[model samples]
Target chain A: MSVLVFAETTGGGIAETSLETVAFARGLDAEVDAVVVGELPHGAAGELAEHGVRTVHHATGDAFGAYSGAAWATAVQAAAGQSRVVLAPGTPRGLEVLAHLAARLDVAMAANVVSVVPDDELVVTRQVLGGSVLEEMQLPDTPALLAVAGHAVEAAPAPAPAVGTVRELTPEVAPADLVARVVSVEPVEAVDSSGLTTASVVVGAGRGAGGPDGFGAVSELAELLGGALGVSRVVTSLGWRPHHEQIGQTGSRISPDLYIPCGISGAIQHWAGCASSKTILAINTDPEAPMVTKATYAVIGDMHEIVPAINEELRRRRG
Target chain B: MTDVLVCIKRVPDVGGEVTLTADGQGVDARHVGFTVSEHENCAVELAVQVAAATGGRATVLTLGPAEAVEQLRSALAVGCDDAVLIEVCEPGSYGPADVAREIAAVVADRGDELVLLGNDAADTGDFQVGIRLAHLLGRPVVNGVRTVAVTDGVLVARGDGVDGVETYELPLPAVATVLEGGVEPRYPSLKGRMKAKKAPIDTRAPRSAPAGSGRVRLLLPPAQPSTVDVLGEGPQAAAAVVDLLERMGVAR
Candidate 1:
C-alpha cells in the first residue's frame, strides 16, 4: 500500500505541523509520497526527502500560488489516485482540502485523528465532543482521507538516504475554482519559539490569569527559566493571547520536560493538549482546581504573588 | 446591489455539561440536542443587516440531514430571504472542506457576489472553514470579523486577534466569517416564525468526493477526580492566608 501525504506550507516553506504529518506517515511504512502545492523553495523537496519520503509530487499553477480549497482538493484527489491513503495535517488548509476531496470522492473524512492503522480495515482514532471524547471509526472504503490534528505527534528526524524523486503534477481546475485570490500574505509578527519545540521548560497560563496584562507575569517567569509561554483557550478567546500561543484541545499541543502552570484550572480540554508533559507543576488559588489534582506537584497560592516570586527567585539564582 | 450568501451549521448545544466514555474517545451524544451554532446565527444576522443597509438580498445555505431544515426555517425567521439545504449522507461526519465545496457549488449556481460564514463552528471549533472556503472559492477572505460595513463599493471590517483588533477594507465578492458579539443575533418573532414555516426551501445533493481511509474511534474523556478546599470568610482572614502562603514559599 502507498500513502500520499499533503505537505502544507507557509510563506513557501513547509509548515511544522506538516513535518509532524510526515513523521506520522513514515511510521506507516508505506511507499510514502509527499504532495507539495505552490512555489516551493530550492531546498524544500530535499528537506522532505530527508523525512523518509521516497517521492515528492510538486503541483504548481498560477491558481496554486494562494490556498484554494477547490484547487488543492483537485490536486490532492488527483494525487490520491495512486495511493491507498491520503494524509494531511489537520491544519485549516489540510482539513478544508481533505473535506472537499472526501466529498468529491464520495467518502467519509475522519478529522483530528490521533492514530491510524492499516489491517483488514483502516481504523482511525479522532477526538470529538470538543476534546472531551474520542471516537474510533473504521473506513471500509479505499483511498480514505485523513487529517491528523496538529501536535498529535512529534516530528522525527529524517532517516538517512536523503534521496527522493520529484514528480511535477498540475491540476486542471475550473474558473470557479480560481475565484478566490490572495491579495496579500503577511507573516504574523511575534516571538518565534521554533526552538521551544525541544525546550525542557514550559510555563503556561489560563483565563484565571486575567488577560493580556496577566500574561506579563507568565512571560517574565518563562524568561527567567529560559522557557516558553503557553496559554489556555480562554486567553485566546479573550484576545489576550494569539491562537498560536494557546495550549488547549484546539490549540498547540506541547510536551515540554517540565511544565509550570499558573492560575490555570486545567479543564479537560486544556489537559488534552499538555497531558504529555514530563512533570507538571500547577499553582492556583483554588486548591480544588482540576489542575491542582492533575499536576505532579501542586501549590495552592495566589498566582499574582506566586508567579512574581518565582521569577524573582530565578533571577537571584542566575545572578 | 450586493448579493450575499450566508452559510450556517446546526450543532449540539454547547452549554450543557459533556460526559466522556471509557475509551477516552467520542462524547456521549444521547443527551446532546441540536441548535443552530451561535456564531453562525450571528453570521446570518450580520448578512441580513448588511443586506438591509445596502438594499440587497441574503440567502442562507446549509448542509445536513433532513432535520437541518428546521435551522433553515429558523434562519428565514431571522430575516433571511431564501434558504437552501444541501443534503449530506452523514451530517456531522463531513468536515469543513466538504461543506465549503458544497456551499461553493450552491453559491456559484446562485450567483452571489459575497459569501459569509461563522468564524468557526461552535461544535468543532475549527476556525478554518471561512479561510478554506475562501481558498476553495479563490476569493479574498477576512476572518474573525466582529464588525462589517459597506462604503462606496468597499467592505470595511474589523477582526480581533491576540495582538489587537485589525481593520480591513476589501472589494466586493469576498468571503468573511463573523465573530461572536459582532452584533446581537435577532430571535425569530412569532410572525416571522410562522412566515418561515410557509416559505419554500430548496433541497439538493451537493457534489461530494470519495471517502478518505481514516476512521474515527469514539471514546469519552477520563473521569475527573474530585477535590475540596475550605477557606474562611472575611477580609480580616487575608493576613493569615498571606502568612501561610509565605510559609509555603508562594509569597515573600
Candidate 2:
C-alpha cells in the first residue's frame, strides 16, 4: 500500500512532526507521497525529497481563505485517491481535518498512533487516554486514516535519494467548504524557534516549582542554558504560564536533543511529549518522582536552589 | 433567542494511575475513579455561563452507558436546563463516525442554537464531533477554542496558536470545541445537587448504526526500563549539574 502524508508547514516549509510522519511511513515499507496546501515555499519539494517523499501534491486555492477543516479535508481527499494509507501529525488541525475526512469517507481514523507494521494485515499501536495505555489494532478498513503520534518517531533521510515531482492538485472548493474561516489569527506570544517542536534544548518546569514566582529561577536557568522554557500542564492550569508553552499529551510534544525537566512529576501526559528527547535530566528534591526515575541524569535537590546554582556554575565555567 | 448545548464525556480521572485491562480493549478501571474529562468540564461550565447571560437555555449531552447520567446530573446542577444520554450498551465500542452521526441527528431535530464540546475527548482523544457535527448541520466550526464570547449575533472564539492566540468570528448557530484551560469548572452546590437529583434526564439511543470500520482494541505500550544515574544532590552538586549540561552541549 502506498502512503500519503498531509505535511503541515511552519514558516513556509514542512513541520518537524510531518517529516517524522513521512519517515514513519517509510519504515512501514511503502512509497511515500505528500499533500501540501497553500503556497509552496522555496525548496519545499527538495526538503521533502530527502525524507522519502516521491510526489509532492501542492494544492493552493482562494477557498482556503482561512483554516477551514472541510476545505483542507476536501483538498486532501482529492489527492488521496491513489494512496492506501494517509498519515497526519497528531496536531489539533491534523486531528480535526482527519476526522472530517473520515466522516466524509465513512471510515475510521486512528489518532496518536505510535507504530504501524504491514504484515498480512496492517498492525498499529496507538497512545490512548493520555499516553497511559497503548491500543494495538489491525487496520479494519482499506484507505485508512492514521495520525502519527507526535514525537514518537524520528525522521531520517531516504535510503536512496529520489528527486520528486510536485503534482498540483487543487480541488474546486465549494462555498460550503469555506464554512469555517478564521477572522483574525494572532499569537499570544512572539513566534520563535525555541518552540517545543523545534527547540534543541528545553528546560521544563512543573508544580514543584512552587507558585508562579518559582518559575523565575527556572526561566533564568533556561535562558542561561540557551534553551526554551517548557511547563507541565499543571503549571498552565495554575496560571504560571500560557497554554501555548505547555508540553504534554494535550500540549505540544517536544523532541529536543536535551530536555531539562525541573521539579516536574513525569505523569503519562507529560512524558508522552518529552520521551522522544535524546537525553533527559531531572532536577527535583523528590528522588522518587516519575521523571527522576526516567531521566538519564538525576539531581536530587530543591530546584529553587539547584537552578540558580547551576546558572552560577555556568557563569563560573564560562569565565 | 440563544440556546446552548455542551457535549461531555465520562472518563476515568486522568490524575490517577492507569492500568490496561487483560483483554487490552480498555483501561482497567477496577480501582480507579471517574470524573468529567478536564476539557469537557470547562465546556459545560462555559455553556452555562453563556446561557445565563444571554437569557437562553443550556443543555448538556453525552453518549455513554447508563451510568453516564452521573455526569449529566452534574451539568444540571450547574444550571443547565436539560440533560441527555445517548445510552450505549458498552461505551467506547463505537468510533468517531457513529458518535458524530448520532450527535448530528440530534442537532438536526432538537439540538440548541449553539453547540460546544471539549477540544478532544480525554479518553479516546478523538477530535471529530464538533467539526463533523458542524458539517452535517451546515454550520461553521472552530476547535481548540480557549476563549469564546458573543457580541452582535456573532461568536468570537480564540485558541492558542504557535505565535499567539488565534481568533475566529462566525455567525450564530455555530460549533466550537473548548480547550481545557479556558476556565475552571464550577463545583455543584448543595442546593443545586438537590435540584439535580430531581431533574429529569432525556435518554436516547444512537439513531444510526455503526457504519464505519474504525473499531479498535486497546493495548499497553512496552515499558522503557529506567535506571536513574545519580550524579549528586543539593547545591554542592551544582558542579556536577553543570558538567552534565556541558556534556549535553546545553552549557559551555
Candidate 3:
C-alpha cells in the first residue's frame, strides 16, 4: 500500500537523482516514505517533507558512513517488510543496494525502469539493448523492487505537508561492515548551467569534431545560444572530453528543447540518448548520415563553416 | 604470498546481430555464441599479469551454468593458474547483489587477498557488480580502473572518472573493476588452449543463502519502421537533395 524509497545522499545531502525518484514515486499512488541512512544535513529533512514524504526513517551507524551493499541491503530488507514496493534510483549505489535487498527478500528486481504503473500486475517499461529498445514488463509478485533510471523523471517541486515524522532504525552489522571506509570526499567544481536537461537549446559534437580542438567551435556556438555542450561516446573514448559531457548511451542523457548536432553520425546508441529532444537540427557533410534522417532540419554542408556562421548569426542577433 | 580472485562472465557478443526469442524474455542462443566479456577478460588478464609479476597464483571464478566452463577454459588458456565455477544459479536469474553474494561466498571459501571484475556486463550493462561485491565483502572498491601495479604490501591503481584519471593507493585485499583499454587482452595460443583443456577445474555450489531478487519481464526491442529513402546517385543529385532538405527546413 506504500512505497519505500532509499533516498541516496552524498556529503550528507540528498542527491539530485534521488529527488527525481521522489517525483516519480508520486505517480505510483503509493504513500511515499523516504529512508535516509546517515545524519541528516541541515534542512535536508525539510526538503523531503515538501515532496509529500510522510515518514523519514534515519538509520545511523558508523557502518553506514560509506556505501556498503550488505548493510544497505539489510536496511532496505527490513524497511521493505512494511511497504508494498521498494524503489531506488538506478545509480551505482541504488542499483547495488537494491540488488542485494532483492536477493535477501527473495523478490524480483527490475533495473533502469522508465515507467511503472499499478495494474493486475506492476506494469513497467524499461530500456534495453543499450537504450536502443523499450521493453514492457509485468511483475505480478508482491514486494516488487525497482530501480528507476536517472534523469528519466523530472523533479517537480511540491508543497510540504502539514505533518511528517522521522524515526531511527539501528541495523545489525558485523565489524567487517565497517572495514570499507570513505577516507575523504572531494566535491567537483560546479559549472554554471543553462540547465542542460531542461535547456531550450543544446549543441552536441562527436568524433567528427576531430578532437578537443574541434570542441572550441562547438563550445562557441553553444555559448552563443546559451546552451550546453554534448558529445558522443567516441569523444569520451578519445579522452577529448570528460565522461559527464558525453551525451551518449554510456554518458549523461539529455532531452533539451532544441538539439543541434554537428559533424556527427547518429549511431543507434547515441540517438537513444538524445532522441527525446523536442527539435533536432543536424549539420553534417555526409548527406546520407543517419542523424540527417532523424533530424527535423538537416543541413548538408561543412559543419566547420555552417557552425561558425550560425554562431555569428546568433551573436549578431544577441547584440 | 598473495591470493587473487578474478570474477568473469561469459556474455554474448553485443556487437553482433541478435535474434529475439519466441517468448521475448531471453536471447536466441542458436546464432549467439559466448565469449569472455571485453572488460571481464581484461580483469582476468590483469590478475594473471599481476600474479606473474608478483610470484603469486591467479584463480578465475565464475557463476553460471555448466557451459560457462567454456569461459573458464578461455581464462586458463590466457594464463590463469586455476579456475572455480560456482554453480549456484543460472545467468539472469540473479541481479548484481545475488552475484555479489555468490562471489563473496566463493572468496570467503577460497580466501583471496584481492578481487577483480569488469566494470559492467555486456548483456545487461549493469556496472554495479564489482562495487557491490566490495561492499558485500566490506572491502574498498575502485571503479573504472585503468592501470594497476603492486607496491610494498599495497596496490596502486589509476581509474577513469567523470573528469580525468584518478590514482589511488590502497592496501592488499581491495576490489577493482577493470575498464576498457586498461590493457590489451591477450589471446590464448594453441599450446595454451591445449593445456587449458587438460587443466583441472573446481566446480561447486556457492554456500551463501539465496537472496530472492525479483524476476524481470524481458522483451525485445520494437521493430523499427522502415523509411528507406535512397537518394539518387551523383554529386549534383546530392546537392539537389540538400536543397530539398533545406526547403523542408531540415537544413539551414
Top-scoring candidate (DockQ): 2
Evaluated at residue A24, the lDDT of candidate 3 is 87
Where does candidate 1 stray beyond 4 Å? A9-13, A158-162, A170-173, A187-202, A210-216, A226-259, A268-279, B3-5, B13-17, B20-49, B57-115, B124-217, B221-252
- Predicted candidate 2 versus true structure: per-residue lDDT over A219-293, tens digit per residue: 888788777999998998878887768888667778888898999989877887788888898998889888998
What range of 10 consecutive residues in model 3 chain A has the weakest lDDT sum? A184-193
DockQ scores of all models, one per candidate = 0.19, 0.65, 0.19
Tens digit of lDDT per residue, candidate 3, span A1-319?
A: 7888888775656777888898888889878888887667777777788877878877887777664555777776666667878889877568767766654555566777888878868978877666654556666657777889876788765554524488778878766534433333334343223455556678999888886788888887677566788888788767787655767554556787778888788876677678778667777887778787767766676677666666555454446
List CA RMSD, all candidates: 6.9, 2.3, 5.9
The ten-residue window of minimal lDDT in model 3 chain B covers B228-237
**Candidate 2 wrong stretches, greater than 4 Å:** A119-121, A190-197, B208-216
* DockQ of model 3 vs. true complex: 0.19
Measured by TM-score, the strongest candidate is 2
Tell me which of candidates 1 and 2 scores higher on DockQ.
2
Candidate 1 CAPRI-style tier: incorrect
Over the full model, what C-alpha lDDT does candidate 3 score relative to the true structure?
0.72
